[model samples]
Target: MRWKHIVAASLVLASLSGCSWVNKLVYRIDINQGNYIDQTAVEELKFGMTKEQVKFLLGPPMLVESGYPNTWYFVQYLKPGHDAPEQKELILSFDNSGQLVGMKGDYQPGSGFFEAVR
Candidate 1:
């Protein structure tokens, strides 16, 4: 009789495992990953600034493709406990001389971003 009770309890737990609401009973920590550059730092980027200057301001990029040395990719992702995840990205392009020339992706550049210092 005791064995039968244990088997029945096991079956009940196995069924509850697939229920989504069961997850709410457990606590989860917030998750933050990747290079998290703030809007102010990105706004500080100037068109004619060198790669080193950008790195100093925004830290290292998340990826630099092998053939695309002039492009830098910055990514940030965050998941707060049970809330939905959020992601932000910024792509910077440099000219042949390694001066930053283009910016794109989710981040918006500041007012003077396009005014190149020729």
Candidate 2:
């Protein structure tokens, strides 16, 4: 009778644990958002590249503010990580003459020197 009671209790516990709501407790995933631009890609950008050239090199800006037409923004964001999301951005500004004159972001603009891999 004790063995039967023990078996019944174990089955009840197991069934309860297998409930649909319990699935969420074990399965979790991280989300990655926005463009993941490579530093090398941005390095290829020169001081006076045209908008078409810039788009070809870096793809379209992930977010474009309608109010600021000349300023382009590229952003990368990751979510739900142990550390802060691997977030970074690059902002490029163009002159009325349509030449790139400014770059401001977490990354430094290239000095046109390639790093030696050796």
RMSD of each: 4.0, 6.5
lDDT of each: 0.91, 0.78
Candidate 1: lDDT of 91?
95
Clashing pairs in 2: none
Q: Which candidate gets the maximum lDDT versus the true structure?
A: 1
TM-score of each: 0.78, 0.66
lDDT (Cα, 0-100) at 34 in candidate 1: 94
Q: Which stretches of candidate 1 lie over 4 Å from their true place?
A: 1-22
TM-score, predicted candidate 2 vs. hidden true structure: 0.66
Q: For model 2, state the Cα shift of residue 19 in Å.
A: 18
Per-residue accuracy of model 2 over 3-34 as CA lDDT, tens digit each? 99999999999997776666555655677888
How does model 1 score by TM-score? 0.78
The pairs that clash in candidate 1 are: none
